[model samples]
Target chain A: MTGSEGPGHQVQAIGNDEDVVRVRQLVRTAAVAAKLSLVDQTKVVTAASELARNTLVYGGGGEAAVSTVDNGVRRGVRVVFSDSGPGIADIDLALTDGYTSGGGLGLGLSGARRLVDEFELDTVVGAGTTVAVVKWAR
Target chain B: MERVPILKIGSVLLVSIQVDMQDQMALQLQEDLGQRIVDTGCRGVIIDITGLDIVDSFVGRTLSTIASISRVLDAETIVVGMRPAVAITLVELGLSLDGIRTALNVERGLELLARNAEPDTFDDLDLLGDPETTSP
Candidate 1:
């Protein structure tokens, strides 16, 4: 998975629980590499865990890419979780705090958004879903 | 499939999770705790998470469920040793972790449980002087 990715990007498969843990570890490494503070690292890592699990449970398994980015003055870590499963029909509903299709707390998407500096969601009804989030060093 | 070991301490059961638990492992801990609570008739359960770096919604929900299950079995559950950062992130994540008790560390958690170990029974009420004899 790492071979096909760019030089700085680390891609990991999210097929099960272990993959989710690996995703979190990879994000943490990238976050540290980008010089994120301890609190920021914690926040981003927690967000990564949520998104990775969503990719596995809701998205029926997928992959995550962790990359460090630089925006001139500041550096940051960005993680993208992509899944080729049943795409979300109601993005807003899925972002609701208490709304869940899989008996979870339903806080994965919304909570993840709050944890990072930038949050983006791209999805299609039948194709799949991709969630990207970035947390910059402070 | 690594299991979280549950240790017996007097009337309380202690589980110190020193692993980066997966979702399935967390669920297994919940089940194991419930069984231990019944088998030992423990009145309190303390889970130490000082070793964990993060506690996401899945693990948080499992803790809540375990607390509820322990309550149903007449046992109190206290989660101790959460890092400051983890707590802040959890609140921001909109997970209040309702119905779950927490303490600063294992020692404090034990104190909280000991306070609830003994209820105010009829004997204790009698010790406070009979109502008829102590009438104003």
Candidate 2:
């Protein structure tokens, strides 16, 4: 739950490089608050960086939310990135490593998925794309 | 936009990244380093990232690019001071940082560069084993 007690209260805009860094800091704070291990914290922060960049470059600027989640037994840090740019036409191709439309390493989507516990992607060809990822503490 | 400073010591250039580098900042460092390598004619580069919290794909790619650029300029690049947690995360993230050499710290990095730069002093010894070798 996103409350004033934690750092994941605001939905920050991902308009430029600065915003990406801000998103990373927010995710790290939330991850630490969720009591994740140091390695897990690094993984989530790295994943957040990749996704935030994708939201800015491929998605043409968007927003991200960092929050802590609970599913009865486990507590996790969740990050949601949403963009209203040209949505991905081929999800599978985009998810493939080394495949990029913007001349990137093509690790943004695929690699981010590997670093987290749960990954979800929703996109529309002409509308937008939203990616939600969760990294749970063990 | 903050710039990462490049310090020159002897023939090696030391770059200690103390900030959380943005995408543009990373690109700026790559360009600045390329220019510094040419300006100083440095033979080796040691990049310290102990202050970096994460080495995401973007940063990893930038480091790789920097290594290539330095190599083209006849310089060696070694990435040092990587945190253990970051290394674990990078591996799970599937980025091996190809073409980039890494060390545990700056001292070892310098040692690596020194070893690589060492000249072969035993070139004449190879002739001893040749078929043209004659008894003294």
Candidate 3:
């Protein structure tokens, strides 16, 4: 029952610093439009910020899609980050906190996972990674 | 290449980051702040982040790095004007910003620095470059 889409779709390129801020703003706007609370907005926006950075730094740049979803019972905001770059060799290890190949906090994947109600990850080593996250209304 | 203004106030340096910020911009601030520490011979630093709506991991790490660099430069870094939502978000993001001092606002931050400045022997200002060197 996830056919209902709210507002519309937004696509932003994540290749540099400016894009990262843009993606965060985009995600926050969609979350607000979905009527998410201030705290929820901050959480989703923070997740989007992390994922977008990963897409740029780790994934070697990509694109993000922002959309609102209505699952018949709950309204939610979703952002899917796709990038074609050297993918994660071990998803588990990559998700582990403090494990970073780029000297980051390594909280991008796991922390983002915890911030949302639904998370989907797809990656193939030497190929790319796609992360989709959604925060539903409370 | 936007430069975050690092104000030289008496014995303390005040910096207020008001932009949404780019990675390079944050790096630039880090570099400029380090240079300012050496050039101004300040003993303390206070970074105000009230204008920032979000402090992602990148910004969080930058702040931590700034604090670390300042400590090594014979100066202290105190971050102020952190919103409650941003704080929660940082925590949920698994970043504690360890070892960074903070205050409610600029006034409190200045007060903290002022109190610490008394009997402050900033004699070893040369430690601004050498992290291995420590002096009170």
Candidate 4:
């Protein structure tokens, strides 16, 4: 898994509890590769956990893909969670805190957004949801 | 499927989550803990997370969930050994871990639980063991 292409770091399944752990581990590895500090690594990993769980529980299953980002001198890690399921109806409401369609603290979206340096989300009602987050080394 | 051993010391249940747990494993631990609390009649629960250098909202909520559920079953929970980085991340991530008590280490967590849940248990250490001779 370590010997891969430049942008391809690690990809893991996000269908169950075990998969969530794998996602966290893979994100940590990517964070390390990006030379992120300990705090940054933890924040990215935590955000990854929330997003992965959201993929599994809400999206019915997805794949978490983490890769390294290098902009000349600075390096970063980006994680993308893509799922094909019943897509969200309202993007604005979904990103709002205390708005949960399922049983959770409703922090999956907003809380995860706060942990990363960059966050992007796309959802089509009949298609699916794709959330991408990036944490740069500091 | 992986089990974090639950040890019953006197009337307290102690578990240190030192493994990289999957989602299923965490849920199993929760169930096992609830059952152990009922079976042992333990008055207190102390979980040590000194081994976990990183904790996300999922893990944080798991700890808080266990604590909250244990309260319903008449058991007090004290989570100890959270790394400073994890705490800061948790705060930034918006997980306050509300309604859960925390401590610095296992010894302190145990003391906190005992002091609040069963003050007499510490006073009557002789009942569990001759502490002067056995445990150092």
Per-model C-alpha lDDT, please? 0.91, 0.91, 0.89, 0.86
Clashes of each: 0, 0, 0, 1
Per-residue lDDT tens digits for candidate 1, residues A49-136, read 9999999998999999899887767888889999998999999999988889998999999999999998999999888999989898
Superposed by TM-score, candidate 4 places the C-alpha of residue B128 at a distance from the truth, in angstroms, of 24
Colliding pairs, model 2 = none
Which candidate tops TM-score?
Answer: 1
- Local accuracy of candidate 4 as per-residue lDDT tens digits, A1-138: 122224757788787888888888899888888889999998899999899999999999989988988766578888889999889999899999878999788899999999998899999887899999988888
Give the TM-score of each candidate: 0.92, 0.91, 0.91, 0.88
lDDT of 2 by residue, A17-125 (tens): 9999999999998888888999999999999999999999999999998888776666789899999989999999999988999988999999999999999999998
DockQ of every candidate? 0.84, 0.81, 0.62, 0.56
Model 2, B1-136: lDDT tens per residue?
7899999999899999999998899999999999999999888999999999899999999999999999999999999999999999999888999999999999999999998887532445554565554445
Candidate 3 — what's its lDDT? Answer: 0.89
lDDT of 1: 0.91
Return the top candidate by DockQ. 1
> Per-residue CA lDDT of candidate 1, range B60-112, in tens?
99999999999999899999999999999999999999999999999999999
Candidate 3: CAPRI quality band: medium
Docking outcome class, model 4 = medium
State candidate 2's TM-score: 0.91
Worst 10 residues of 4 chain A by lDDT: A1-10
Model 3 per-residue lDDT tens digits across residues A1-138 = 344677779999988889998998899889988889888898899899899999999999999999999988778898999999999899899889888899888888888887888889999999999998999889
